[model samples]
Target chain A: MKRRNLLATAAMGLLLASGGAFAQGMDKVKACFVYVGPIGDGGWTFQHHQGALAVQEAYGDKVEIQWQENVPEGADAERVLTQMALGGCNIIFTTSFGYMDATNAIAAKFPDVKFEHATGYKREHPNVSTYNARFYEGRAVQGHIAGKMTKTNKIGYIASFPIPEVIMGINSYYLHAKKANPNVELSIVWAFTWFDPAKEADAAKALIDQGVDVIASHTDSTAPLAEAAKTNGAVIGFGQASDMAIPEYMPTPRVSSIIDNWAPYYVKRVGELMDGTYAQVDSWAGIKEGEVEIGMITDAVPEEVKAEAEAMRDAIAAGTYHPFTGPINKQDGSPWLAEGATAPDGDLLGMNFYVEGIVGDIPQ
Target chain B: MDFGGINPVILIATLMASAVPILLAALGETVVERAGVLNLGVEGMMVIGALGGFIVAVQTGSPVLGFIGGALAGAVLSLIFAALTQVFLANQVATGLALTLFGLGVSSLGGQGYNGIKPPPTEQLLPDALADLPVVGPIFFGHDWVVYFSIAMTAVLWWVLKATRVGLIIRAVGESHEAAHALGYKVNRIRLMCIAFGGAMAGMGGAYVSLARVPQWVDGITAGAGWIALAIVVFASWRPWRVLIGAYLFGGITVLQLNLQVAGSVIPVEYLSMAPYLITILVLVIMSAGRKANGAPAALGQNFHASR
Candidate 1:
């Protein structure tokens, strides 16, 4: 069966070569996105949808955008990707880490169709390209702010899952917070959910009750901010995937936010497809590449603290500083990086341990 | 008392608030099952209620009227199930499942513009003086109006079920619809009222979540809360007061688990995540294994025909 499939792929490649449709660029490209959560979630999936919209606006008539929201990340993803591929999708973007395997499986089946998987490292097929933002860079900025802004000397993280993406963010947040405040204590609350507002609210309340004045959540909802809003001014938090610096929680609960700017990446990839320059690339861009942005810092932060945080942000964007620089130790107190050395991309992508000071298991 | 930073007062208060949605929803399902009808679409009614309540709250800027609108919307949707099962004599289980799917889809469709919109805060029923009375103040008095309303509903439902003739008649119809019909009571009519009542309760529960708890509109906002409510009804053995206990136990465990995780306890937080459902399952085993408890209404989920 494998031999037959390989022969079929070869024949299709030969036919495509003879037809020479994509030899230069094509006039029109249909870009598709599959989201893991509802676009109304106001966070991760919403930001991705914003990126999809930017692709449409970038090329008015040259690109046709199609998307399916709340597509679960297992067998269902494979079926959706297969449907999109069969429906003549020029390029399909699977916008969740859980969809990695499904994306590659479908990409293998449809060798002619290009596949892009976000925040995932697996690219078993050449048509598949992996892209992720160095969110820890933004985490460094937020953590620095969290450490500086806390009145209780304790901060909390309402983490969604134990994935590397979330782990690295926590590590960077704690490390930066500790740097800003020598006596800072970090509390971690694992909610183990992506989008349940009630549970997320409970997580936030738990932290607030613990006297953790600064809260950070990896879950995709405004519940954390809403909970912080109830605290009046005792608790402050940062927006997760999107800029949640809305009026209700603004300048107080939401001191700042880390906005995931996928517009540049989306438009660039789709443009490459149209311009016949698209190829497999493992792109991991951050603040420097404008894929990760520090949202507008509100006036709630003290002047000097805000200036320091901005300087750190500038350093990250300028590629002169790394959030996971050396002088770091694993949770067990073994040195992971030497002084003056930065974390390698491979280590960051596969991060599974807490940096020394964070007090809790990763729920392996 | 603070046990490893797990404050008893805050934990109880948070549990009461979090449990209100499930408590109200389970109470509604208990009433429906007692009336000899099994409406498995509580989740659907609740989500529709969430959307309806959120829309009304956003439009009128009144959390009270928004709750009423949510209840009304749930009643209107359940009337479709009532008409299908009670009137048309369709399969109750299938119709109920279909209602859930329909509710989720329609609410998401209706919820296009309501995203990220926070409803007006539901105010506390008691004064700040009463709420600031230390441990008792926060635990018993600091909660908003819906928490009190949920407790009142449990009492009212219990009175209407255990003592009153209205409760007796409803149970008579539930236990033996044919006998009730022979004695000149309209079983379907009684069930129609009960089903609508159930939907309103479920809808109000959904509204409480949107307007009071989460206070934002998201598609499928009720999540699987309705199913949990259904499980509680079975676990409660169709008793109203037991449903209240079951709901609080579930809600308390959820709150407790979060607190425990924050305290960095020795208990595996991963296991704690599933503890609530695990207890529900355990209670279900005990209830079914030991037959001394009150069981489901015999006429539950049955179609009634006057001629037959």
Candidate 2:
């Protein structure tokens, strides 16, 4: 027993030495990912898996990539994260807003295992990091197009959750739509899930029945476009998380899309680990960093509207204009930003209110 | 025409469409339970049906044929459960759960390369002229054939179960299989046939989601509708007409909740969000405590083995 104790101590010392070495230069890096939806979802999870695949292509044999899909964000995530950490995942990326707490909790347990959480702002431990794409930037583009094209002036948003990330998208989309057309009315139905195709379809159908001609969804699925297809040119919608440019609904219901581009950030972080320059970082990149892209504006949009939307996109990409630029007000008519004043990062990160002129309370 | 921004006609129309899937699934379960079997694999069978229906619809370019293919797929999958619980004398509950896991595995494996593909549009049965008539037209007409078929099935199921000789044999086998065996009735054989009917119905219900409602293939597309169907069976006390009422009640509240939110009603979204589950639980509890629950098959969930 005494010899076993001594041997265990010696093994612990060796592990610590290797962990220290791992903190520095490493010959090989194993990057793992946990996704909230199936990779075949053709939307959010599909795109994140694409980013994981990009890491493999970028580093080849130097990096080993592993991923688990359809991981629900809660205790299940903690279990999966702990397993991956014990399995020697050098850096684990939890790719969903709901995983904020689990990522931080698991990060604390495994101080040597680096953690990167997407679209969340909880970095309780030094080993945990947070990164997110400014998806609202893409929403701004879709809103402008939705506002310009809707004949009914009634638009709808199928919200996944009441989280700040989704709330921010709602406000941005509605703000831009309200700016383009003062008469536009935005209807929101919280489906309360990230990727249930059947529920998403019901929400979209509800909106269509209520005469909403322009639709946008915060959830991950193409069923919204499929439901929009049933309208046969009456209603139109934009693809969320992926360029749903499928031949079935393209140029019609899927007039445009917001593609989440995580490859650059993913490849960059994996490369940083390889070069011994890794540090806990908070990244919030948008169109400028190529993290958020507006998919092609189909010919269905009027030429002038398409051109104007493209101009806004370029301005956003060039850092000359902010999507949440001034003259904005809280839902109750309280002033949020003065004219010529853009929203600060702090306010957008924890946004919880609907902008003015968009009626209805945000579900708490 | 509107109550709290919800057009009653349109709300009812959407409710009918939404309820059809669960209605069909629950209706099938009603038959299975009456025949003295409880297969909890409705979810498994439904998802496989979704995949089968979507693939066939996309391949053959015929939505009608797609539903048939879905039924065939679900029936084939349920046969595994039927064989296990009936012939092999496995525990119905455990095998049903395993069947769900197996179906999920088979679907994800089979669903490769079918993502993002849309099935052909399901044709609405009625003429547009009839469908365009105000209130009544939108509320009662213009749905795909499944809606009418489900309602027809409900009525037919009620008639057959309450008044027919075949229904008597199934119930006899369910109430006392030993007595059924003494009467020279093939107990396991009758249960097998009933399980197949349940599977075929569940498959069609699942096909409705992929072929008409969502009209696209996604892994696990049924998403617990089968479990809800099981719950509805308990809620309805295994009766056909009550299953319809239970399905529509759940469906109505589901559609109304979203419409209420869209209308920006004074009701809280959080409360509305929980309303469906609350009502379902409330009904299930009330029915189980009531006298109607005496309708349960005496020999439900039991395996039959031949004896001297």
TM-score of each: 0.93, 0.95
Residue range A1-364, candidate 1, lDDT tens digits? 6999999987786566324335668778889999988788888888999999999999999899999987887999999999888777889999988899999999998887899999999999988999999899999999999999988899999998788999999999999999999899998988878888888888999888888899999988888888888877889999989998677777888999999999999999999988899999999999998999988899889999999999999998887998989999999999999998999999999999999988878897
- Tell me what TM-score chain B of candidate 2 gets against the true chain B: 0.97
Candidate 2 residue-wise lDDT, A1-364, digit = tens: 6999999987786576338435577788889999998887889988999999999999999999999887888999999999898777889999999899999988888888889999999999988899999999989988999899999999999998898899999999998898899899999999888988888998998899888999999999898899999888899999899888888887888999999989999999999888999899999999898999999988889999999899999999999999998898899999999999999999999999988888888888
Residue B173, candidate 1: alpha-carbon lDDT: 89
Show model 1 residue runs off by greater than 4 Å.
A1-25, B292-294
Worst-scoring 10-residue span by lDDT in model 2 chain A? A14-23
Q: How would you encode candidate 2's per-residue C-alpha lDDT over B88-174 as one tens digit per residue?
A: 999999999998888877988899989878788888899999899998887788787889999999999999998999999988988
lDDT string, candidate 1, B1-308, tens digits:
89887988988998999999899989988888998999999999999999999899889999999999999989999999999999999999999999998998899899997786778989998999999998999999998889999999999999999999999999998999999999999999999999999999999999988888887887767868999999999888888888888888899989898999888888887898989888866765575675764777999999899998
Please state the interface RMSD for every predicted structure, separated by commas: 1.3, 1.0
Clashing residue pairs found in predicted model 1: none
What DockQ, between 0 and 1, does each candidate earn? 0.62, 0.69
Q: Which stretch of 10 consecutive residues in model 2 chain B shows the poorest summed lDDT?
A: B284-293
